[model samples]
Target: MTQNGFEKTGDDALDAAFAAARAARPQPSAALMAAIRADAAREAAAAPRAARPRPAPARASTRPWAGFWRALGGWPSAGTLAASLVLGIAIGGQQAVPLAGLDILAPASGPLDEAAVADLLPGIDAFLTEG
Candidate 1:
């Protein structure tokens, strides 16, 4: 049966039940309210007063040029840094290097002539026949 809320049994019954339940709750005691207020106040006071400086924000600990020195140490396949240094000085130093300590019979320090290179190829002449 639909009516313009003249049907009291529907809305009226719900309102009355809610009102009855609301009336049954005991009022909070003043002592309990005071304790809750005291807790909130203590919490406010106990919190840290100022923001602490967070470990001075860990600045970059490495120097920018560190990798350049590491690169000079040389990579594995490229050859040892120590060996390369000696070889570079010997090769790059060229005619400037003194050869006094070397054996006297050794070939000269500079590039050889075309005729001299023909001497390196093995031939019957290299057999060292005592004739």
Candidate 2:
């Protein structure tokens, strides 16, 4: 339809129905607009307000810790840094697993056996079998 990308139906029956409805719709009278404008004028004249000064713009912080805190960028980035540090400590200390079957899948690539996976994640078997 129109600019929304759907096809516009050009049926004569629907067009006649729409034309009838458009002719039947109620229209605003000139008296209503006159009354609305009077009410708006009355309210504006009744309310008296004091003149307020504009606030001064904020300046950047110059403290030593301010640069550090700004670099951290608040709690979301801080939490991300803490999570990355914990994961780094966990993965960094893990022992490397030795692969044996290097010719099964590819001539150079090693086999991904159970022992190899166990060496990578010790309790993976227990976790997988816990139904």
Candidate with the greatest lDDT versus the true structure: 2
Residue 9, candidate 2: Cα error in Å is 90
Candidate 2 has its poorest 10 consecutive residues by lDDT at 1-10
Candidate 1 error regions (>4 Å):
1-11, 23-26, 42-99, 102-110, 114-131
Report the C-alpha lDDT of model 1 over 1-131, residue by residue, as the tens digit.
43434233467787677567667878889999999999999988787756533566656449777567666663663467667889989998777655684543355686565455555645635555646
Cα lDDT tens digits, model 2, 77-114, are 99999999999999989996657864343435656777
How large is the C-alpha RMSD of every model relative to the true structure? 10.9, 22.1
- Residue 100 lDDT (model 1): 84
lDDT of 2: 0.75
Residue 79 error for model 1, in Å?
Answer: 27
